[model samples]
Target: MDTHTAATRYIGPTGMDPIFNRIANWLPKLGIDVAGGRLLAVRGRKSGEWRTTLVNVLTTDDGNRYLVAPRGHTQWVRNLRVAGAGEIRLGRKVEAFTATEVADADKIPVLRAYLDRWGWEVGRFFEGVTQDATDAELADIAPGFPVFRLA
Candidate 1:
């Protein structure tokens, strides 16, 4: 349905500040959600074991929820691609569902909403882009940020 071709250009993840990353993951594991943060667990493609990580969940005006990758094409993105489903957990409360990659051309709105919500925490990964960025700007950065619609 998208007129734009899928974006193939990938930007690898920047090194996260280890202490910050750990605390972020720890809080959610302890059942405290920080500004839309949740623990996402999925089966690893190679290990076939449950892998968990911190993710920010965004629910837009139209009620559609999504998980946007601030860091480009990371391990979870790769695993989800193969697994096709995962769980979004808030502590012991786990919601299992299928995941579909949002086509690059169609990621504009989702990216915008994600930045609007998590920009302060994840703005570094966007390379100067922001929620207020134009459609073209968002489009240009879309491919680097993989998005998933959780159903």
Candidate 2:
């Protein structure tokens, strides 16, 4: 499937994924950004229940806010696609907004910035691409990482 199209893909996590994700989910609840994380909540496409997980929110210099899925088309990513909207929450702060996925061709800047600001935490997920990678390199991996602009 062309992830650049509507069919996004996923990169499975290692065994430690659940452990780290669980710990990450706690930091923001305690008002800590141990991973530059926030709680992302979206309605379940099947159950209509709100589902949440820890995610990284990237804000560029120009004031655009985004959510990048290093783990690729995760459950939240699929739900967000179906829901078309979601919430970003810190301890007590919740910002609900609509989201639009960025096309692979246009994800260079967003991907670079996301890696630039957070590679230390998520670099392994990118198959060795880094913040300093060329645009072509980032574009090659763009389709695999779902990015959303928060409005």
In terms of lDDT, the best-performing candidate is 2
Model 1 TM-score relative to the real fold: 0.89
Off by over 4 Å in 2: 1-8
The residue pairs in collision within model 1 are none
Error of 2 at 132 (Å): 1.4
lDDT of 2 by residue, 49-119 (tens): 99989888999999999999988888999899999998888888888899999987988999999999999
Worst 10 residues of 1 by lDDT: 1-10
Q: Which stretches of candidate 1 lie over 4 Å from their true place?
A: 1-16
Q: Write down the TM-score of every candidate.
A: 0.89, 0.91
lDDT of every model, 2 decimals: 0.85, 0.86
TM-score of 2: 0.91
In candidate 1, what are the lDDT values of residues 19-130, reduced to their tens digit?
Answer: 6777788888888978878999999999999998899888888888899988777889999999999999887888998999999789998998888888998897787889
Go through the candidates in order and give the clash count of each. 0, 0
